[model samples]
Target: MQRKITPYLLVLPLTLFLGIFTYFPILSSLDLSFREWDFMSSDKPFVGLENYALLLSSRDFWNSLNVTAIFALVSVPLRLCLALMISSYLVREGIVSRLLRGALFLPSVTSAVSIAVVFSWVFSTDYGLVNGILAAVGLPRVSWMQDPQLALGVLIAVNTWKQLGYDVVIYIAALQAVPRELYDAAAVDGGRRWHVFRRVTFPLVMPTTYFLLIVSVIEAFQVFTIVDVMTRGGPAGATDVLVNMLFRIGFSLFDVGTGSALAVLLFIFLIVLALVKAHVLGRRVHYEA
Candidate 1:
């Protein structure tokens, strides 16, 4: 009995820490989502699911959800494809490959806020480098930030540029792990480049691809700094994301209950997305020894 109790005592601190630090906060947020209480006010009113209903009925919430969905759908595939292509090229043995890989990965180590600031200047209407180059080639100057449609696209492009490097590194690692013997066997079989990739390389890399897909989706939903720094949810709430909406409600409008409800809803949506992806795509992932 003492031996069993001693092992339990060893893990008790960690269990208690997780309960206090992680589970407690989550439970508290869920509880808060069902109540009406401004952080500054003394009286707390029980609202049940009223906050969730309010957000679901609000046009702004739906609009932000649409914007977030568009951003995720557009950015993730482009970023992953570019990363896979670049990583594939870099994985080939050569002096230039090493140099190029290092260069490509530099952006991943840089601060996002700094990147956003630089991109803002580059996309600036009056004196941005992009406009200057377009003008040099005899083209019209477009307002990237001020235009509602263009603002979200600009943010998407910026995010893709910043994130692609990390994805490239991930793909590169997976590519390196693929056996050279498989490529040799494909060569012996007179396999074309596409055939080799389709039959041997891609199948083995599916696990990494699935992992990146889920993580990219999750990160895309939490995108805030780029929107905050570049457009501030834009000219007409065009770039407003659910997280950004939650921020506006909680910090700007001071609607604590509504904000908590939004957070809960976002959390639920992400969980459902992750579970669906795992259920649907998990079987598709191939693990190689």
Candidate 2:
């Protein structure tokens, strides 16, 4: 009895913090989703799914959802693939590899706002670094953040660049943990380089890949800071992601109820996504490494 009590006591603080900061906001949002109240309003009135209905019917909501889906679908795979490739080469022990790893990881630890601001200038139209280079090469300047077609792609690139380092670090650890005996056996079996990688290295790294996949998907969906800082949902809502829309509705517009509804919907969508990924990919993950 004392042992069980002691374990529970050890986790009590964490449990309390989770309940207060995470669960409480979630429950409050759920309740708010069914009500209508601006931040300044004194009397909150229950609306019985009206906010959800409004969001479902709104063009902006659908557009935001589409943008967010595209962002996640494109960025997650790109980030993972690049990270895997980079980590494979960087797994060797040396001063250069260590230096490269630290340089790559610098962005992961940097503030998102700082990254966004720097990128905003880098991709700026009139006096941006990119345009300056293009002009120097006798090419026309291009608007990276203002064009509807290009804005979301810019956001995706920025997100992938920022997240690639963390993924590489994780994959490097996973790659290094793989048994060298497997490689020796493959070489003895006359396996080609690609064949060995396809059979042994790739399969062995599936667990790490799957973990990164889930996390990257979640991060993609919840992306807001970069979009907010760089484009603010863009010149015509081209880069308006779900979370950005939620922020606009909830905080900027002060439509607390509507914002809560969007928040709940986003939460539900992510939950469903996680469940689907678990169902589809969970079995393929090899934990033997």
Candidate 3:
């Protein structure tokens, strides 16, 4: 009894902290989603799923979700693949490898808002460096942010570039853990570089790939700073993601109930995805240790 009590006592502070902070806020948000509130109102009217109904019926919500899905689908795989390939290549080379690795990893450690600001200028339709280069080459200047079709792609590219560094670091670590003996055996069998990577390295790195995929999905669902700072969900809401839409509903429009509904939906969606990922993939990690 004393041993069990001691363990419970040790965790009491953490339990209390979570109850006050995490659990309370989640419960509050859940309750808030079913009611109507203007953020400063003394009285919150109980609306009973009206906010959720409105969001479900609204075209904006669907559009934002579609944009978010596209952004995540395009950015996550490209970023992870590029990172894995570049990191693996770098770890096999000499002095240039070290220099390039450091350069590539810098963006992940930098501020996202600042990076978005710089990209905003770089991607500007008029007088931007990208358009300037196109003009110099006698190509027509592309309206990057102004065009609805191109805006989401530009935002996806920015997200990929910003997140590439961290993925590279993760891939580098995974590549280093791969044994030299495996490579030697592959070479002795007359295997080319591509063959060795496909047979040995990729299989060994499957666990890391799964991890990056799950994390990228979660991160993609929470994207807001870039959309808010760069495009403001402009060009007819082309780049509006779920989080940005939530902010617009909750804060900008002062409709807490609708915002909370979106938040709850996003939270539940991510939670389900995370659980499925863990249950399905957690059992499949290749361990050589």
Candidate 4:
């Protein structure tokens, strides 16, 4: 009895915290999805599946979902590949490498809103550093965040720049943990760089890659701050992701029921995504390294 009580006590703080913050909110949101409310109303009435039906039929919700899927599919592979290549080079430990790692990770620790605000100016058509370089090379200045065709791409670039540091840092740790003996054995058999990476290094790093894939996809779907700060889901709603739409519905429009429904949908989508990724990638992950 004493041992069992002690174990429960050890986890009591975290259990209580989650109960208050996470579980309660999730249950409340699920309950709220079935009720109509303006978030300030005294008389909250049950609306059944009316909110879900409206969201499913709404063009804005579908558009936001489409944009979010595109963002995740494009950005996840680009980030993973880029981080892998960079980590391959930075795996060797040295003073310079350590300093570079810290410098790279600075963006991850920095505020997301701050990064968006700074990049907003950097990608400005006039007096922007990016356009300034293009002009120096005798090219026309281009509007990055204003055009619908280009705004999503610019947001992806900024997100990638802000997030790449974390991926690189994680990859470096994973790469370093890979057994050196395996590489030596491959070299002894005359394995080329590309071949060795394909067979050994990459296989060993698949677990990390898979983890990052799931996280990055979820992040992409839930992206809001940068979109809000820079585009406000505008330039014709080209950059409007799911979280942006949710915020607009819940906070801006004060439609709590519809917003909760949207949130529930987002949660279900992420759950399905994680299941699919686990089913596809779990078998390929080599834990022996």
Candidate 5:
């Protein structure tokens, strides 16, 4: 009895913390999704799915969902592929590899807001570094964040650059865990480099790939800070992601109920995505590596 009680006591703080901060907010959001209440209002009226109905029927909601889906679909694969390729080169233990790894990973640990702010300057049209270089080469200055056509793409590029380092680090760990015997066997069979990687390295790294796929997709969907800091989802609502839409609806417009409904929908979408990924890719993840 004493040992059991001790274990529970040790976990009580964390349990309470999660309950108060995470679980309670989730429950409140779910409840609020069905009710109409501005943040300052004391009288909360139950609207009974009206919020969800409005959210689902709104063009803004569909636009946000489409934008988020495009971001996730494009950025996740690019990040994973680029990370895997870069990590393959940086896997060896050497002074140069160590320095490169550290440099690559620095962005991951840096503040997302800070990164966005810096990138805003970097991509600015008039006095930006990129524009300066273009001018130096006698090229045109491109409006990266202002143009509706290019804003989302700029967001994707910034996000990929910021996230690539973390993915590379994870891939490096996964690559290092792979048994050398398999590569040796492939080499003994006189397999070409690409063939060896295709048959041996990739198959073994499927578990890590699957893990990163889920996480990166979720992160991409929930991305808000960069869009907020840089574009504010501007230039004809081009970069308005689901999370940014949620923020605008909930906090900016004071439409708490609708925002909560959007949040719930986003949550459900993410859950469904995870389930689909598990069903499709889970079986292919070989843990034996």
Candidate 6:
């Protein structure tokens, strides 16, 4: 009996932790989404889809959805492409390469708020480093964060800078794990570098790329702190991503039930997107490599 119980005992702590923190919250959110209540209210009246109805009809919600979609679609590809190329170069073992990887990855470990704060100054219209360089070059100062046309672009740049490090590190690991024997074989057959990479390296790295795609998409949707710190989804609501709107509704406006409904919708949207990704990309991932 002792031997049989040992495995269950070992797993019990983790199970309990998840139950308390993860599973319970998800269940609570689901329940809350169907009811109307403020955070302080004792009475949570069952509204039964009213929150969802409002969200689905709201123009702000749709705008947020569009902005989030654009952000994810644009940023994910840019980050992944740059990370892949950088990792390709940095994959070789050397002191300089290691140092560069550490430098690049510093941003990933740093606080998001800290990064946002620094970038706010960097992109500031007057005293910013970017504008200073523009002045030096005799170019007109551009409103990076203040212009409605440019605010989302600024956020995208900041986000890309912050996330590049982690993606590069993961990509480096994936590139390194690629069997060296395969490269040697390709070289023996006189495979050109670009051709060899296209035929072999790219295919082998598909699994990593697929995983990063899913994670990065989710990150893009949840990009609240940087937006809040930098633009507060402003310059005429041009940068109002979904999570920012959700936070505004839930906490800032103190609309608990509506916010929960929005959260639930976001959750469901991500789940459907993930399922679509798996269906489309899963077969292309080469686990063996």
Point out the worst 10-residue segment of candidate 2 by lDDT.
280-289
Each candidate's TM vs. the true structure? 0.93, 0.97, 0.92, 0.98, 0.98, 0.98
RMSD of 5: 0.9
RMSD (CA, Å), each prediction:
2.0, 1.1, 2.2, 1.1, 0.9, 1.0
What is the C-alpha lDDT profile of model 4 across 155-183, one tens digit per residue?
A: 99889988999999999999999889999
| Inter-residue clash pairs, candidate 4 | none
Q: Model 3: runs farther than 4 Å from truth?
A: 1-18, 276-284
Error of 3 at 119 (Å): 0.7
lDDT of 3 by residue, 9-79 (tens): 99999999999999999999999999999989899999998988999999999999898888888888898
- Per-residue lDDT over 40-103 for candidate 6, one digit per residue giving the tens place of the 0 to 100 score: 9899999999999999999999999999999999999999999999999999999999999999
**Tens digit of lDDT per residue, candidate 2, span 110-225?**
99999999999999999999999999999999989889999999999999899899999999999999999999999999999999989999999998999999999999999999
After superposition, the stretches of candidate 2 with alpha carbons farther than 4 Å from their true spots are 1-4
Cα deviation at 38, candidate 3, in Å, is 0.9
TM-score of 2: 0.97
Candidate 1 local Cα displacement, residue 283, angstroms: 1.8
- Badly placed stretches (over 4 Å) of model 6 are none
Tell me the TM-score of model 4.
0.98
Taking all chains together, the TM-score of candidate 3 against the true structure is 0.92
lDDT against the true structure, per candidate, is: 0.92, 0.95, 0.90, 0.93, 0.94, 0.94
What would the TM-score be for candidate 6 when compared with the true structure?
0.98
